[model samples]
Target: MLRKNILLYFLYIVSSIILLFGLGYTKNWENKDIIVGFIFLGCYIFGTKYRFTSIILLVTFSVLSFYFPTGIIYGKPTEAILISLIQTNKLEVIGYLMAIKYEIFLSVLFIIIQFLIYQITKKEKNKFKYFTIFAFIFLYIVSLFGISVNHHGINRNAFLKNSIDSWKVIRKQKEEQRINLGDSSAIKIDGKIDNNDDTEIRVVIIGESVRRDYMSVYGYPNNTTPFLNSAKGIFIDGLVSAGPNTQLSLTRTLFKAIPTENKIHWGINVVSLANKAGYETYWISNQGANGWGDDVFYNLSKLATQNKFLKAGDFNSGNNDDEEMLPILEKIINSNAKEKVIFMHMIGSHEPVCSRIGNFTPNFKLHNEAGCYAATIEKLDLFIEKITKILKGKKYKLMYFSDHGLSVEKTEVFHNNNIVEEYEVPLFYLDSDIKEQIHIKKKISGLNLLDIFSSFINIKSNVTDSNYNFHQASKITDNSDPIIYWDEYRPFSTIQKKQPPIKDIQSNIIGDTVKLENNYKFSKECVSYVDSVDVAFPLNKEVYKIYGWAAADKDKKPLDEAIGVFIMKNNQIYFIQGDKQARNGVRDHFNISPGERDDYGIVSFVDKKYVDSIKNTYLGYKDQYNQYHICIRNNQF
Candidate 1:
C-alpha cells in the first residue's frame, strides 16, 4: 500500500509539472516563465491537503492559469471575460463554447487526471495537512501583492481582483447616477434656446469604434466610404476623441465637460439639454440595451421625448448593425415633430469585425479582419445614403461623428488608449442646401461637441463654452490644451510629438538654381533593363533632376542588390523610394535617397510647365543585380 501511494504521488507531481510548463511555453518561453511554472508546480504539490475538495479547487485553478495567457493574447482579460460571462445569455454562451471547443476538451482531460488523483487519495490521510494549509495561505498572500515570476504582465491573482474591483466601481457609479436622474432640477441649462428657422431639423449620428484612417472618404487607399466622399459635406480633419472607449468618450462628448473636469454630469447630457431647450429630442440606438455602462446611456435616453433601443439585452445580445435603426429613424423623421434633434447611435465597426457585416457581401477582397472592417464601413456608407435620401429636400442638416476609434496594428484589432489611432475619428456635417464641400484642417477634440451642437441649434448657453465652435465667429484652435483619454483618463498632448515635423517645401526653395554637370558616373550593375522615366522641373526655378532605377539580376540573384534615387540639392543628398516603402508617407524628409529594387522605377520633381517637358526623358545605367535607368523629361507621363 505504501509503494502504491508513492507511485500515485509521483504521477501527480509529474502531471502538475507538465501542465504548468506547457502553459508557460504557450506565452513564449522566457527564463522567468519557466521559474514561475516550477514555483507553481511546487505549490500545487506541497501546499494543498490531499482531499477531494482541495484537489478539485487546485485542478480548476491550474486549468484557468494554463489558459489565461491565451485569453490575454486575444484581448480577453479577466475583467472583460467576467463582464462577458455576466452579460451573455445561454445561446451566446453556447456560441462561445463552440468557438473554444478544443480548449474545453483539454480542460476535460485535466479534470479527469485530477479526479483520478482525488479518488486514489480519498482513503489516505495527509499527516502534514496543517503545513500545507499554511503554505497555501502564504501563496495567496504573495499573489495578492502581485509577486509573481512570469513577466509578461499576466498576474493571475492580481489581474482577477483588479478586474472585479474595476467592474464593481463602474457598475456602482452608473447605478447611483441613474437613480439620481429622477430629479428634473438636478440638471439645469442656464441658456436661451432660440431657433430662427422652425422648419430646420438636425440629426446627430453617433458612430461606434470607427477609425478615420480606414475610410476612403478620409483618404484611405480603399473605397470604403464612396457615398460620403461624393456627398456634399464639411469634413473636419484631425478630430480626436476624448477617450478611446465608448463609455468615457460619449460621456464627455454629450455633456458640457470642461477640459479640466474629471466627472461627467450624466443628467446634463445633450439629450437633457436639448429637452430643456424645448426641442423634440429622440434617441435611437442599435447597440445593446445594457452592459459596459450602457445602463447610464439608457438612463440618459430617458430625457429624450422618444427613445428606442433596437438591440435590447446585454452585450451578448449581439449587434444588429447600423441599418437596423434606419426603419425607426425614418418613422421619427416622418413624424409630426417640427424642430427636432434626433440622435442616432449606431453600432459601427465594433469587433469581431466579421460579425458586423451579417450576411452582406464585403466590398473589398483583402479577406481578413481588415477586409471585414472595410466591409462594415462600406455598409455604413450605404446606411448613410438611406438616411439622407429619406430626409432629402427638407430643411435638414446631419452631423456624423464616431464615439471613438479602434486600433488596428498588423493582424490585431483592439481598443488601445495609448495609441493615437484609437482616438482619431471622422466628423462631418452634411447640409441639404450646401452643394460645395468644405474641409477643416484644424485639430479638434470631441469634448467640444456640446458647444458645436449648441452652435448648430442656435442656442446661446451661459453654461456651455463656445470657444472652439467652428461655425461661430469665435472659432479658435487651441493646441495648448491636452487631450485627455484612456481608462485612467490621463491627458496627452494634442500635437503628435513623436512624428517628424513636415517642412514646407515651398518655403525651402532657393531663388538661385544649381545646374547639374553632364559628368555622370553610372554603376555597372545589370546589362538588360530599360524603362521610360518621367521627371519634371519648376519653370521659375531651375532644379537638378536625378533618376535611378534597377531590375533584378537573372545571373547573380544577390539579395543585397537594390535600386535607389539620389538627388543632390544645396550640397545635401536626399534619397526617396516609392510611397509604399515610406513610413507614414514621410519619404521626402530623408537625408539619404531611399530605393526600391522590386518595381525599379523613376523619381523626379517638377513645376507645372516643366512637368510636361520631363515626361519622356530617358537615361540608362547598370547596378550589381538589376539594370538601372535615369530619366529627366516631362509632360504628364
Candidate 2:
C-alpha cells in the first residue's frame, strides 16, 4: 500500500508538469489547464472522487487564457488597449482577464463532471479502480509522447521558466526593447541628394493584416479592390506575400536573399536608401508605434525631409479609412517640394472590419469565412475610391499590396499553417506618367518586391541580403538562395525553386498583357544560421532630438510634435507641453529600456486634453497600482 501510494504521487506530479507545459502551446486555457490537471490527478490518486473541483478549474483556465494576451506591445499605455477590450469581441485586455475568470468557473464544472464519473463507477472495486488509474496514466503518457516527438526541444521542465519559452519569453523581450527604444531607430539617411527632378510622386501604401487573393484586385469575385480597379496602377497580377505576419513578410518583401553560411544584419533597408537618394520620404501610418517595426519606419521617416506619424485610434476613433489620407496628401501636394516619395502605411483590411466601416454596416452580414472576408474587401474598396480621387491631378505613381494574406475561413486549429492563400497577395502598380516603363510583362512573383524600388529611382540594384529575392524567369531564374518560411513552431527553409504549372488567362488590366506561364510553388529549405544582428536604431540622443525630444537645433525648438501621457493612477491627468525637456510642473519621463523610452509614447495635440484629463482622474484609483504612460504624438516618446 505504501509503495502504491508513492507511485501514485509521483505520477500525479509528472502529469501536472506535463499539463502546465502543454498549455503554453495554446493561446487559450494555459493556467487553468495546469491547475485542473493537477487537481484531477491528485483527487483520483487519493480516491477523493470529487468531479466538481476539476470542472470549475478547467473553465477558469480557458477564460483567462483568452484575455491575458491583450496588452499593446509598445508606446505609452493608452486606454487604447483597455477601451478596445471593452468594445471588441475579437480580442482585448479585459478579454484576457475574463478568460482567466472563466477558467475558474470551468474548474467548478469539471468537479461536477468528476462526481458523475464517480457515481457511474461506484459499483467497481479494486480491479476496476486500478484499471481506471492506469487508463488515465496511459492517456497522459500518450499526449506527452506526441508533443515531445513533434517539438523535441520542448519539455515540461523548460515550460515553467518565464525566460525559457522562445515564443512567449523571447517575443516579450523583443517587445520590451522596442517599447523602450520608442521606435525612432529605424531611420538611416546616409547622404544628401543634389538632384530631385523626378517630378512624379510615388506612393507605396503599406497595408496591415490584409490578405491577398481575397481582394477583387486579385480577380476575386468580390469587389475588394474597387478603388484600384478604376485607379491608374498596374496590379502585378502575380504577387504573393512572403509571410503571414508583418515582421516576416516585411523582411521577405524588402530584403533579397544572399549566400552566406552565417546570418548577418545588413544595415539600412530600401527605405533608408530611398532617403539617401533625395526623394522626400514621408511615413504616414495609422497603426501603433510597435506594429511591425515602427521604430524602423519612424527612423526612416526622419531621414526624409518631411515625415508624419499618425495614430489610428485617434483619428478614426477606431475606424480605418482611406479618406484619412485626403488632408495629408493635399498638404504634401500643396508643398513646393519638387520630388516626393510617400509611404502610406494603412490599417488596411485588418480584422474587426466592422470597426473600420464606421456606422455603415456591410450589405452582407454573414459571419462565415467567405462572407466576413468579402465584406472587409468591399469596405476597402470604398476607401480606395476616396483616396484615388486625391491622387488624380498629381504626377503620382501608386502601388498597393498587402504585407501578408490571412486565412479567416479555416475551421482547423492550425489553419494558417501550409496554406498558399495566406501568403498570396494581389500586386499592382499604377503609373500616371510612364505607362510604358514596366519591363516584365509576365507573371513576376512578389518575391522581389524591393526590386520595384530600383525601377522607381531608375537605379539597377542587386539588393540581395534577405531570404527572398525578385526572380523573373526571363531575367534571373536561379533558385540558389535558400527560401525561408515559417510554421507555428519556427522558421524553416528550402533550397530549390519549383514553379507551379501556369495557365493562360486574359484581361484588360494594366499589367494583364504579360502572360504568366507558371505559378509560384512553396518549398522549404535548410539554412545555416537563423539568428542575426543588424544595425538597429537604438533611438540614441541624436534621433531623439531629430524627433523633438532633446534638441534638433541649438535653440532647443522641439522638432516633432505634441506630447501624450498615460496615468497608472486612477482619475488623474498627466500633461507635458511639446516634445521637449521636462518643465518645472511637468514630470520627466525616463526610458524603461536600455536604448529607448516607453513610458511616454507619441500623440497629437488633438489628444492632449483628453489624455491629460484621464490621467489626472487615474490618480483617484490608487488600487489599480499599474504603470501608466504618456505618448508624444507624431514623435517618439
Candidate 3:
C-alpha cells in the first residue's frame, strides 16, 4: 500500500486539526457540547455518500476554534459571535478572515488530501477503514478529559450542532429583549429641573482600570495623581463601581439595572433622562467605542446630543490618549448649548500600561510597570488640568471616577481577581462653586448611580426622589453599600480586607537608578533574617507564584524599566524581562515593606516534563542601593 499513504494521512489530520481549533478561536464553533453531538456526527458520516465528510467537518471546526480562541485569550465576542456578527462591520469580519489566512489555506489542503485519499482508497478493500472510528474515539475521549478538567471544552462533532444551538439561544434572547423593549414603555421623567443656569458646565470622566488604592489623593504612597491631589474637590472615600469590568459597571451605572428574564433592562437611563430634561448632552471618548465592554458606552453615547469617539474598535491597543478628547470637549464647550452635560471617557490605564504612556516622559515616575501605570494616570491628570484650565473663569463642576480598579502584585496587573480593589474606584468632584474641598467617607455602590447621576446632572424626575442629598448621592443610597463581584453584591464587612501598610502611608520613597548585587539566600523566616531552608520538587507556573517572591527584591530605591530577571537551569541561564510584583505572604510567612523592599518576581511556566528536569535553579534581583538578593527555596533544588 506504498507505506499506507502516510503523507496523505498526515496532511489530512493536520489540516483537520487546524480547521477545528482555528474556528474555535473565531467563536464560530461551540466550545461546550453533549455526547449526542458525537452520535449525530457518526450518523452524518455513515449516512453521507461523501466519505470525506468527517474530514471536512473536522477542518471547518478547527478553523472556528482557532478564531474563537483568539477572542477568548484577548477577551472578545463577550456577548456572542452571532450578535457581534449581526452588529459588527464587514471590515472586521474580513480582518478576522485575513487573520486566519493560514487556517483557510490548511482547509484547502484538506480538500486536496480528501481527493487523494478517495483516488487511492477507492479500489481497495479499505483495510484502514477503522482509522476514522479510532480517530473519533480518541478525540471524543480527549475532549471529554479536557471538559472534566477545564470549564471550557468542545467535544468531537460539537462544531455544527452546538453552534446552531448557541445561535438559536442568542437569537431567542435578542427577540425576547426586542419584544420586551417594544412592549414596555420607557420610564418617563415629568418634573422641573434645577439646571436653569445657561453657562453651567458639567463634565463627567469615566476612568479605565484606575483603582483608588493606587491614587495619592486616595492615600496611596506613590502620589500617582498630582493634579487631583492639589485640586479642591469632593473626594469620595467609599465609591465602588456596580461591577468589576467595563461592560457591567457602565451598563448598570448608565441605565436602571432592573433585570427581567435574565436580561438587563435598558429602561430610563441617565443619558435618556438628561436628554429628556432638556440638557445638551455630549459623549466624547478617547477610548475605542466598541470592543469587550465598550458597547455599553456605544449604546448610551447614541442618546447624547453629539458624540465623538477616538476609534471604532481596537481597544487596549493604547493608540488613544485622553488628551485627544480635550480639543473636541473644548469645541463642545464653545458651542451655544446653554446647559451641557458632557461625558468624557478616558482610557486612564487599561492593561499593558506601557502602551498608554507611549514616548512622553511622565512627570510622575516609578520603577518599571508601576511607572507605566502611574504615567497613564498622570496623562489623564494632565488632560484634566488642560480641560480645567480651558474651563477657567467658567461655572463648571467636573466629576471623575474609574470604572474599576486593577490588582498589582509586583509589576504585572491582574485585570480582575475579584479582590476588593477591583471595585474601589475614586469618585472626585471639582466644583468651582465650593471654596473648600469636601470628603465623603462613605463607600457608595454604583447600583444607585442612575438616580445619583440624574441628581448630579440636574435631571429632575417625579418618578425618583428629587430631593438631592450631597453626602449619600440620591434617595436611593445604601447605609452599607455593597459591590457586585462575580455578579454577587458583597458587603465590605464580609470580605477579608488588608489595610495599607504603615510604610505605605508613612513613606513616599521611589527612586530611579539601577543597582546590582549578587544573589543571596534567605533563611526560612525570610523577614528579620535566618532560619533553615527547605527543599521540594517539580518547579512549575502554579508553584512559581508561591515561591516567586524569592526571585524579586524589595528596596526603597527603585530601579529603572530596563531590569532583567535571570533564572539558571542546570548550567544554562535564562534571562527574562522581569515583570515585577510587590505581592507579599507567599504561603503565610512574612509581611513585605512597600518602601524598603522592591519584591520583584522571578516567574516561569514550564511543561511537566521540564519541571522534573530542572535541577539546580537560582533566582535573584538587584536593589537600587546595589544590594544582591536571591531566594533559595529548598523545594526546587
Q: Which predicted model would earn the best TM-score? A: 1
Model 1 misplaced stretches (Cα beyond 4 Å): 1-45, 56-60, 63-125, 128-131, 141-164, 182-187, 192-199, 255-262, 291-293, 312-321, 358-366, 407-419, 433-435, 472-474, 478-484, 492-637
How well does model 3 score by local distance difference test? 0.53
TM-score of each: 0.61, 0.50, 0.59
Per-residue CA lDDT of model 1 for 1-637, tens digit only, reads: 8887686666566555444432434333455444444544555565435664456445555555545323422332333444444433332333344334323333444555555666666666777667677666665443333363656443343434555675786576567576655444554455544445454578999988788887778787767788888888788887878775676677778865655555665555677667777789999987667754576677778778888998668656654667778889888888885789999988778765556776666454432345556677888888888999989877888888998766552222445544667777888888887787777776777777877776666565665664545453225564444466543445556424221111121231211222334433443443222222332221223333333333323332212333334344444323332211111111111111223222233333322232222223333332464343333322211
Model 1 residue 506 lDDT score = 25
lDDT against the true structure, per candidate, is 0.56, 0.41, 0.53
The C-alpha stretches of model 3 lying farther than 4 A from their native spots are 1-185, 192-199, 289-296, 312-318, 364-366, 462-637
Residue-level lDDT of model 3, residues 1-637, one tens digit each, is 5576565455444434433433343233443433434433343233122345445544444344444323322222333444434433232343334333323333343355445655554454433456665655555444322232355544433444445665677667545434443222565666655646343788988888887777777786765678878888778778777765665577667666653333456645666777777788999887667653455557668778889988866454446667788889888898884988999887677765656675556653333344556666667777788889988888988878787776554334435333677777888878777677677777677665666676677656754555434434433344584645332345545445442312222112222222223433332322221111122111111222112434223431333333333344444444333334432222112222212544333333222222222334334444565444444443421
lDDT score of residue 46 within candidate 1: 58
Q: Quickly count the clashes in candidate 2.
A: 96
Show the lowest summed lDDT stretch of 10 residues, model 2: 505-514
Question: Model 1 TM-score?
Answer: 0.61
Question: Best to worst by lDDT, what's the order?
Answer: 1, 3, 2
What local lDDT does model 1 show for residue 599?
28
